[model samples]
Target: MVEKWLVALQVILAAIGVYQFTLSLFGIYRKKKHKEYEPKKTFAVLVAAHNEEAVIDALMENLKTVDYPKDMYDVFVICDNCTDNTADIVREHGWTACERHNPHQRGKGFAIEWMLKKLWEMPRQFDAVVMLDADNLVSPDFLREMNNDLCSGARVIQGYIDTKNPHDSWITAAYGVTYWYCNRLWQLSRTNLKMANFLGGTGMCFENQLLKDMGWGATSLVEDLEFTVRCVKNGVNPVFNYKARVYDEKPLTFKASARQRLRWMQGHFTVARRYFFPLLWQSLKERNLAKFDTALYTITVYTVLVTFLLTGYMWVDAALFNGPNFPTLYEYLPTWLAVVSVVATCAAFILALILEGVKSWRVYASLITFPIFLLSWWPITFYAFFTQNNKVWSHTEHTRVVRLDEVHGKQVS
Candidate 1:
């Protein structure tokens, strides 16, 4: 009975993995419609920070260098629960600053909510709002690309994210690979299918009215995912803008990223509990594929959890008690089947890297260690089970202040 159950469970997990992978490949069929955009829409660029004095000036300077009229867009910084001079620097740079010191209410979500209310009360109105991380650097044409998409009837938009510190460590390089895979595999495919795109934590733009209508009070540790679930329910999906690039600082150490990943996993599960069944039920009733896809995406972490558990069980059961006398993975699943799974995964990574124009030896070399990075998610996900109610988060520190070209090893300009 144990052997039969293990085989059946493995089959189910295999099918789920294959389904998700195949679905991600829909980007290969995506058709792009391009147009020249007049940068007419005024923007309110928002930066959320806790203790980012080291990097705020660079972000502010980068914003000033954006290839758009200086008067057309205004920058706003929310210094939420900061002990450093993060707000003072924003003021020094002549940007709008909202300094919130409420010890009880923390996290980016609360900070954004407070700032939004304050902004709406002011006389000046922004056509759209773009949320950026305090540690991020933007492309010169980032706003222009967003304006084009906004004018073309996209109310929500997310930009492409590249690591500003990819070469700093193997961990950051692995993050680059993971994001490269995500950029095409997830966002592009969803756009091609006319489905909802997940709101990236940073580098996302939204029409002010859409945000107001949704009552944007997403306070989860993973506010982006929470906002995404709410947005999909209200029929507002983010559109992908590949040219609108945002350079984010990936965690260089495993400890920093592990905490971040666990928080993300916890938030994902929270959102899934709140939205998945409703989405699944709605899809069944209204026959909405978009909702179904979003639900499918949400539950994948759970599937991953099951896969890990079952793999461990099978390994132990085979080595200790099974009659097949230490059966190899190929004994449970056919050799050809295992080979196909690995080949498909490799093919996806190759396509993503090639499409993203990555030729770095560092990035290629890190691929050998990327599986270890992926494996770490298992433990992180396990910890996520106990952290569903975490309200506060530790901020990932960033101190890299070099020009984009320096970190990227090529002249970006």
Candidate 2:
């Protein structure tokens, strides 16, 4: 009887996997009809920085070359509780430095809220606001692409996030591989399907009115995800712009990377618990597919944990007790079907690399060992589950600095 129940659970989990698999297929059709538009929107480009003296200058220099009207857009650096000369660097670059000295409320989310309130009080009005990290390098066409999206009626947009230092180290390359894979398979696919795209911490843009409507009150560790769920519940879907690209600096060491991912998981678990039921209820009330999809995404973070626990129980029952041998999902399903799933996964990974224009051999080799990185998340999810309420922010130090031209290996016009 226990074995039968276990088999049923596995079948249900496998069905969800199939749903995701079908969604990934849509990613392959990457072509979208993007309309060319004049730059009529004014932008307030906001960069959140904390003790980022090493890389802030490079980002400022990169922003100077953005292919948009200079008077139409302004850059503001939120120097959040910085002991270093982060604010000084921004002022040196002739951008506004909004120095936030609140040690109690110290996170990217808080800093952004503070800055947004200040921007609202100021005389200058903006059509949209773009959020970025201090270590990110934007493509020259980023603002132009964002302008196009705004002109075409997209209120919230997430730009493509690429790695700035993929070949810097094995750890960095693995991080690059994960982002590259997710950017295409997840973000692009959801865009093609007309599903909501979540706001990545950086490379996110929001219409000023939308931000004011939502109040920008997501002060969690993963404020981006929290705000995304809020947007979905309010019937606003965030769209993705593949042409608007921002290169972020990845952590160079495994220790740094683990700390970063652990914080992300902790925040993810928090958002799931807080909004999962509300989103489900909203979806049912409205009979909206987009809301249903967003609800599934909010709760799907735990599917891995549930799957791991079930598999472990099956193994222990088979080994210790006089029970049926641990039955694989494949045992209940067809052998050919399992083989096809494996083949499809490999093809998807290879397809991501090819479509993302990943030229670094080191990044490719590091991705070959990417399973170890995925496995590492199992322990993180377990730890984060227990400590979801611990909202203490863990800052991942970014020292790797690369210019916009260096990332593409050519002069970026």
Candidate 3:
């Protein structure tokens, strides 16, 4: 029984691995000739800040010089239960600032919903709305790229996240590589295949109507992800605009990374519970591959669970259950699939680093140890399973602010 079940598990793991690898490969070779579109849409850029005074000044400075028309967008900042000068700085700097004092209501989603409510009551109407974190600096062309997509009839969009402090530590280096890998492996790749891309909590844009229609109430820890799936269910597909970039801070310490990733893993499970079955049903009922793609995307963590369990089973089988006639686990793993699983993923990461033009020797040098960082997720996954039911939002501390010109030593478009 154990032997037979092990075979079944191996097949499932291989299938899931191949699916991800195939999508990544398609994303790598897939390129499109983008048609030029006018940047005519007006936007309200929303920033949710929680005691982010350390980095607020830098983001404000970056926003002031964004390469779009001055009147095309207005920056709105929300100081959610802030005990610091975050609200004061925004107000002092000649920008709109809203103070959120409700201790009962926390997290970015609730804060954003409150801000949207305030905006809905205002006299001005916006064509689109963009959400950002206070620890981020926008590329000069951030609004322009989003405007291009909005004009092209995209209702929701996500921008690329470039790490502002990649060389801060090895932890940060791993975080940077992961983002670069994901930009191509997931979002850019999904965009290439004409599928909806997931949203990074920061640097996401939605049509004002959609925002109002849903009341900006995706209050889960993974609000960006929850909202992305909600958009798909509502028949709205999000487009990825790689040219629109936002530089965000990464946690420089292992403890900080663990805290942040735990929140993410927990929130992912929260979202999967509510939407996974619906997505699967839609895919079967409508014969929609895209819906199925999103469904698979939601449950990919199961692959990790299976991977860990299979390793334990193989260990025991080899030691005690080996009948001498029993085949090794490696023999069961398909040769081509096994080779592609390891080779393709690493190759994709290398290609991403090259494409992103990261020149720091430290960033490249850390690639050798990046596997250790990736393996950290396995333990984090189990940690989340124990703590997922706890509903508390623990924000990662983000004081690091290495500006674009400082990191790359040149102007970035």
Encode model 1's per-residue lDDT on 77-184: one tens digit a residue: 998888999999999989987889998887888899998998889789999999999999999999999999999999989998877888788898888888888988
Candidate 2 structure quality by residue, lDDT tens digits, 129-173: 999999999999999999999999999999999888877777777
What lDDT does each candidate get? 0.83, 0.87, 0.83
- Across 60-107, the per-residue lDDT of candidate 3 in tens digits comes to 878888988888789999999999999888977778989999999788
Better candidate by lDDT, 2 or 3:
2
* RMSD of each predicted structure: 2.5, 2.3, 2.5
User: Could you tell me the TM-score of candidate 1?
Assistant: 0.94
lDDT of 3: 0.83
User: Model 3, residue 61: displacement in angstroms?
Assistant: 1.1
Best by TM-score: 2
In model 3, residue pairs whose N, Cα or C atoms come closer than 3 Å (at least 3 residues apart or on different chains), thus clashing, are none
Candidate 1: pairs in clash: none
| Predicted structure 1: lDDT | 0.83
